[model samples]
Target: MPNSSANQVSVIALTQIGAALARKIQGQLPISQLVLPEKYAVDGEQSFGRCQFKATCQMLFKTSDVVICIMATGIVVRTIAPIIKDKTVDPAVLVIDERANHVISLLSGHVGGANAWTNRIAKLVKADPVITTATDTEHVQALDTLAQRFDGWYPDFKYATKLINGRLAAGDRVNIYIDSDFRGIVTDLTGFTEINEVADDRFDVPLVIISDKTGYPKRQNSIQVIPRVNVLGVGCRKGIPYDAMQAAFVAFCQQHGLTWRSFYQVGSITKKQHENAIHYLAATLNIPVKFYSADNLQTVADHYSQSAFVKKTVGVGNVANTAAELASGSRTFTDRFATDEVTLAASRKKLKVDDS
Candidate 1:
């Protein structure tokens, strides 16, 4: 939310007092404003007109990352009930009292960040946060929060969450096994057991295995967290079809024992910045695409596998390796692989934990 524009919060007020309170809170955060009735509308404020609460909520739910409602709990719940879907995709929803005495996280507390937002608003407005999430109340870290912190992806989160949190609530230790060292993941958190090796007969304890390796052993009461460490540097022939390039890329990762979820980004030369196929692959993987100029790639050319044909055609001996090195700020972790029309290389970026 700080650097990326994808997720934005929307704050809505239903009365003049609520509108005034919303303005005070908005000054402390980045959010869009919506008010009900013409009288409640401050200058430059967007008004939903008379009696359009439900309609406004429907639209905001679809577009906003989080919806902060300054109104009664029952009114907010009834308005959003019909449109409620899966918690993973839904925006965080919070409700505040008109007098700003209590800030309640009404929905999507964990993954959608409603609980965190509630606490933030509460501190700003001098109110109490009514957070009911069991893990938060018990002072234990949530599995989803860990995954977000590491930029890891979880498969079958619902089952994983229920099993892990149930173990924590029952005073059982949950084992965490990470293949690579990641900073700021406090192993000392309550109810967590960091294991160095795979343990036998730990089915009673929930296990969290973090890695990018393929074909890892699966176990009951366990979950896999895929860290995004691999950066893909790609080069393709002009006018190549996206499907062809995508298939090659997938095959390369599969052959190398890498998961697509481990990819942090895709990089390429600036000439391919407008290439539809590269952009398509990036969007499909939900990863960012970074481009570097020929001069930039040339600086790292000595560290890459060079090709005479590529040098003659593109002014660089290697595109994939050079671009990957620039994107990752490190040398290639794996050798460059090539198809007839596309070249792929990979690098691993060091993970920096945010202490703040």
Candidate 2:
């Protein structure tokens, strides 16, 4: 089994069964259902309502990395399919038994770390792991052998598991840039895009998702590709004058045609703990941010796209660079700013993003 831990993950449950499971798995994992007061409920009724379902599911899907559909009379599945069918973040769909804690990895089990998760749940709840994915049953094979297929170029493809399979079928090459010997061919791993599977970084790759996963992709011949056309993020005091930050961010975005969502993470001056501006930006851009402390900024030395003036003055890359780097999962970006100084930077990762 793949050894991994739950870092930043989100969960969505369709029914009471799903909600119960979500609550049980809390702390050990991430969940989508948040306890809300009756007054805040959209249904204008008591605890749960149809409106609540719609609004809750919408919010849940937005932040979730996976969606777990609890089995019932199948109403739960029916109610939430349309909402999820069109979601941008392809959530790993799983079906769990309401009666027993048994977890069935119906869709995404490996690529989204559901396989490992399945076992964890089984042991915790003392239930069965009904993992039907072929890769899990068989140890040797490419991701294609077990990957669930879905439509590429669709917002739904963002579902990690479905997208992996779709990318493989679409002829996206898997450029494994690992150093030392690594087991399994490119085809053997679930959702690999490349057929060559050779241990060479020189192979062509469209999307480069850098991870700390060892021996997967070698560094020697790897090329750095910024995955976004524009990246803008800002950090300021609680009520600091928004002029500089807003101007910088807007100017940078206007200079490049990029959607607000492209801005990934926000690196702020540690002193301004939980500032209002960050919350406002999150609302405006509709993107989540992974806040970084000053020390964490050091690891991104290589990827920081710092300008001469920005670098000389702030002594770090701009916010856009940090956001882009963090969003793209690359270590080649970082930015810094003072409490009063709201900084922004931009990248061209959107140069050739597929519209299809």
Candidate 3:
């Protein structure tokens, strides 16, 4: 199975039959089964057997990516209400009947991925996925979900959900402006206008802008979806704190007017592969990390700002600039920016689409 730690799922069962069903589901999917002390059976690193359901659900709801409760929906709802805070940060909650006849997505249907999980489980168990979200029933896609699917990000999600999808749900026209030809990222273009540029006077209708430009199309009703086109090359001292690395990167982006969400991936030297801070930063940003050897970095060294000290210490003339070019497989988009310990640079990756 894939890394269970990365995509953690907690399954809680109240009855023996439910526990049996939970085990079956866990065997099929990459998940950790949580059962009472008396019903503990599965033994492995993946099993979290012998735990209180209410407490486990409360804890996992905050920590796990998704939570599956195989019991009465009412009981799961009442247990989690006290701890629930924001739908954006909350884990997807799914409630399935003990008999495995039905699967209902209870909370965070879109942003939290509950709706998708419900459909997957329903298919496996031959049960109906009861999705209560209006957008799913109305055949209107959620903007946040679309952003995730395209490896993009949007700010003010609540406002976008309320304004953009709301207008579409009411049968209103919505305009989408992309600086480049990226229509292939979107599957449905039924009620959207694909334009090369958005006019300043086009603020009356809902708009979705996908671009990497510093600043363009300043409007209130427009939701900017930043495409993952830039590669972030990073070089940091060993044992650096994750927060420091993240803060330095954020500051660099702000100074350059770059959107951190537009970063396609993070690149570093292969020696730093075991560095916890690097992995932590990549995981927190939801971006993959690419490692390059000293030899690989040397191939792009001539195109970057070379440093004798970096060459002497790390066997490379430059770390950030070379890694950025190597990661993007293109020229540098901006000059290298450095902090006391961390260095960051960026390169643009061109987007291509078929005309036909």
Per-residue C-alpha lDDT of model 2 across residues 1-356, encoded as one tens digit per residue: 11123324444444555456655665365433333223332333223344565565444444456655455526545655666553224455555676555776654455555666667667766779887654455442233222221101112223433444344445555443221112221223433433233443344453332221223333432322212223334544346554555555655445443334345444443444466666566556665555554444445644654556644443454544454455445432223333335655433222222222
Q: What is the lDDT of residue 245 in candidate 3?
A: 89
Q: Pairing residues by index, what is the TM-score of model 3?
A: 0.72
Which has the higher TM-score value, candidate number 1 or candidate number 3? 1
For model 3, the superposed segments whose C-alpha errors exceed 4 Å read 1-7, 34-37, 40-51, 189-191, 234-261, 264-314, 325-345, 348-356
Can you give the lDDT of residue 130 in candidate 3? Answer: 97
Q: Top TM-score: which candidate number?
A: 1
Per-residue alpha-carbon lDDT of candidate 3 for residues 35-85, written as tens digits (9 for 90 to 100): 433544445423343545566667667778888889999999999999999
lDDT by candidate, in order shown? 0.83, 0.44, 0.78
Backbone clash count, each prediction separately: 0, 27, 0
Instruction: Sort every candidate by lDDT, greatest first.
Output: 1, 3, 2
Could you give the C-alpha RMSD of every candidate to the true structure, in order shown? 4.1, 12.4, 6.5
Model 2: residues >4 Å from true position, as ranges?
Answer: 1-22, 30-47, 85-88, 141-177, 180-356
Residue 232 displacement in candidate 2 (angstroms): 16
